[model samples]
Target: MFSKIRKAYQLFKSIDFEQLDKLSRKVDLPKVMDSFSKLDEKQLNGLMKMLEGGKPKRELPPINGDFYELHLRLSEEDRALQLKVRDFMEREIRPLVNHYWLRDEFPFEIIPKLAQLNICGLTYEGYGCAGRSSLMEGIIAMEIARVDASVATFFGVQSGLAMGSIYLCGSDAQKQEWLPAMQQMKLIGAFGLTEPEVGSGAAGGLTVTARKTEKGWVLNGQKKWIGNATFADVTVIWAKDVDDGEVKGFLVRKGTPGFEVEKIKGKMALRIVQNGLITLTDCTVDESDRLQHAHSFKDTAKVLQLTRAGVAWMAVGCARGAYENALDYTRKRKQFGKPIASFQLIQNHLVEMLSNLTAMQTLVYRLSELQDADMLRDEHASLAKVFCTLRTRDIVSQAREVMGGNGILLEYDVARFLADAEAIYSYEGTKEINSLIVGRSITGFSAFV
Candidate 1:
């Protein structure tokens, strides 16, 4: 006991007097010393070792998809807006996505919350829009999709496809009538372009025909896989004019005579997005309701080009969400009495996922830069769409791979991303179509026909 007291006294003498003084305020130092003096030799040695701190634990870097730090390149204001959208998504969207996704329904209550962000029509000028650069729009899209791709799809339909059609191809009257309401999300919108029979052949072969008459123009045909159409207030319908054989755009309002919409069911992926099969049996749209400037397929392509770029950005978000969730899961999940993330095989999968995700992020950033510079062409958008979406598919699949059986379980989130990636893969443009667009641009050959 005397030896223990001597050792404890000597140990305390070595501690910094300043630290001891600070500790006296919080603890009864005299009582501590008295207790320490009564300890056995083994206890004294343990106390001595604790006083001399052991080896420091190393801090590892966080897991992030933006390995190249592309988000840092955004201007201060743009970065703030990006973070705001990310916060909204993470807070409002993430918690309820799996529930809604499993039920195949949208959370309509979020529309007003989404409107508060003031991001709709972000790249367009005037009409209550932000009129920000396209890069900002891409970042916003990525952030929204990083939580739920179905919500992102609904937004893209409203902001990009529906509003972009009017912004790029509508007359002054049409813009004034629609852009503001849509920008506020007070009026949800959808785009009807892909027909049941005509998927990739929409450029020259639209079966939906519009016949001109003194009363109005009569449209007859069917449109399938129209996102948001089940609840959209308005849809931008593309039809071929039988008189001149030219493609024209029309703002077909809800409940129009002879226009019928049937909600599609049993979708394998992106089920939360309300896709509709629209039937126009002699539906009459006013002459003024037609997109005044959309005279041919070339005019329609303008809107597609704009939205396709946004789709590429959305693909990045889906891959990012998957990679991040899978990365986090690996860290917590243990195998063989250790974290699976520490395993060489698991680390290889993680590194491969990160490599693809980083590449996608950097490519989309440059793609948005080109768009903001007004130098973006069809091939440019198509290439990014092709690469990002293709890589996103692979990244999500690998994310599932690392997660083992839990990857398919919805609670883990990678499963949702994995399922949603299939929808992103086919929408806006398919891989084959986009690749051909790039191929034609590089080779100067018309392979699409």
Candidate 2:
């Protein structure tokens, strides 16, 4: 029995004895191990081939953040701009983003370099815009958020939401006057829509009131979560018209009488974004400042339509950032005498995260495609927004989980993503709000009250 045990040890060295014992019920281990031990070089090779037979080989393509080959689809000029922005983000933003996030402060120095990207108002035709495809614009948004979500939010407000208001709703003269300077980032813009008491319900519940007087329009109300409002040269404010009861938009230039902005502090997510609580006490603006094309809440919905798709792209970027960082960390982190990634349970978590991330990437790609074709509807963007943000929350959580105790540490990087994902989930639209948008479209019922 001692000799047999010694020989069995040699044969089953690579295979666990416990596993071999389990296999003994199916195959006589004594005979099998003896045969395995006696096999010469040629016979051993043949036996190995037979054991692996009939299993199809799966050669997976290399993992990449840009799953749909979007960079290759861009024109040379646009591709160059994309790379320039990516380079700027990697060099200027990546190094200091975590620092700012830790301190909950904005990095003012990087603004100049970011302004140099010439990507603001990317999809708008004329008015100093590159007039690129919406797909390219979406790609740039993804790239920006992939590095730093706060910066992306800053740019999105200045470029898409704020500038887009003027581009889509302002008069022809307003576009000519503001587009060039804003595009160059010489004139920064902020959007004021959500109020201190209203958020997702801004469509019908804006507390800000705009009363027309001999001087102009008097705006009296408060806005909350207005990004970049603290330092913006111009803030696009949406308020209810006193006479017509329709929601109207105004281009309230900075320093307007009765207009004030105060920074909102102690935010757990998107800390780098200087969100503001704006107050308007009889803030008067010239008649020309009123958005000529913005007749009602439906018009404001259009602006949201354009920006919501970009938010979905941002969600994809966030998940990708967390995934890449976690994957790299797992490969390098060792535990129990081997890489934690080599453990079965850890691998399962990783695969789950990757699966969700891949699904999000594909969904956003399709969403952007639909948007570029001008076939995108609210429900289309809403679906992607709901799906991606939900998945991003899950993916980032798993990312932190795999990091263990270091997951909660800001220096580890994944922790920032985990925290910031909460903002992404709430902003643009909450999970329930976005789902209701999609549900209304598919079921032909308006569930939002």
Candidate 3:
């Protein structure tokens, strides 16, 4: 013990503040100070070995976004795909994400690079799909969202909702017609489910009416919060049949007469995604465009079941993004003549954020596993969606708290995450709605009226 103490004292004595200040520019000073303060003599010596340009007995590598080492558990092919997607997100998306997000525009230029990843329509069996597991798809969602939520939402609508609708419900001929091009990103698709008045109650209360006509089917209604609708080549519009009153899905091609899309404005979150308010007034579709397997709302629920889990993964990504940024900021930011990270309260905030982030990571990991096993249910997806999004709200808020005023600034990165978390919390299904799903499963009582 005495030798350990002596070594620690020697290590501290050798620490060069000048060197530390230079390296501090690269790392978090507050975090270093906090770690330094907590170290006993022996630990201090070990840290000094790394910090003071000495040959150390032990060395610790840099921290990364994957705190739970998720990549390690993935199959080699899936792991490679994850990295490829991450690189694309960081290189192509990250640089322009904030600018497009601020201007409320999509960067159409990056589509080609994104297409090169060959990740579109992931988890589908054929039509040029990679046919990967749900776990890989969820991880890709996280990777994209960790950089930008808008891009992730855009991808989700296309890959999980729009294409998934066709993949799961369309006839083989319909799949052959759309999936290949969509998989190549040659054709963009959108899913139109929520109506202006319906929102979460869309399943049972669709006001959009589809009337059978001698020519074909005429769709008349409005869809609100429809992602990618403004510029999509095709949209899957869910409407109730006028004759049978059964909810049916239609592939409404763009430029169809009476189908108009007006971009929704004033969105503070997911600003880069071109959400559209679509009005269908006597919009006609061929009988062939109807999704044959979509007999009722039950079919739509299947698409949501797949994407809701991805939303939970996106929530985890958002929380992780905020936590990492906050952690990086707190270590560099100084207060009270030392790094603020040296303060107990700041460390407490970080620990809390990490704990929530870690819990979310573990939960989503297992959630994806269940999805891969074909055991995913509405309640299972809802539990993850509710838990992760709620905890993400808390995590991002605490992340902002630790960063002080800088947390609110967009340039700092945490502010955008904080703002984006709000939209994620409400979209897909509200926390209350999702909780009710779990509530119904466990308690056998439906709380949603």
The top-ranked prediction according to lDDT is 1
After superposition, candidate 1 runs with Cα above 4 Å error: 1-58
Whichever of 1 and 2 has more TM-score, that candidate is 1
Which residue pairs of candidate 1 clash? none
Between candidates 1 and 3, name the one with more favorable lDDT. Answer: 1
- Best first by lDDT, ranked: 1, 3, 2
Off by over 4 Å in 2: 1-63, 67-80
Q: Residue 314's C-alpha lDDT in candidate 3? A: 96
Q: Residue 241: error of model 3 in Å?
A: 0.5
lDDT of each: 0.92, 0.87, 0.89
RMSD of 1: 7.1
What is candidate 1's local distance difference test score?
0.92
TM-scores for the candidates: 0.89, 0.84, 0.87
lDDT by residue for model 1 over 1-449, one digit each (tens)?
78887887787687698988888899998898789877888888877778778555557679677888887888899989988998999899888999999999989999999999999999889999988999999888999889989999999999999999999989999999999999999999999999999998899999999999998999999999999998899999999999999999999999999989999999878988999999999999999999999999999999999989999999999999999999999998999998898999999998998899898888888998998888999999999999999999999999999999988999999999999999999988899999999999889897866
245 Cα displacement, candidate 3 (Å): 1.1
Name the better of 2 and 3 by lDDT.
Answer: 3
Q: Residues 260-359, candidate 3: write the lDDT tens digits.
A: 9999999988888999999999999999999999999999999999899999999998988898888888777988787787799998998889889888
Candidate 2 lDDT over 1-449, as tens digits, reads 45444544654577776886788789986687666566566666565556668366655445465554656756898788778887888888999998898787888887777778878898999987988888888878888888878888999999999999999999999999898999988898999999888998988899999999999999999999999999999999999998999999999998898999999999989999999999999899999999999999999999999999999888888888888778778877999887798889888988888888878877877787888888999989988989999999999999999999999998778888888888988888888999999998889899988
Clash count (model 3, backbone only): 3
User: What lDDT does model 2 reach?
Assistant: 0.87
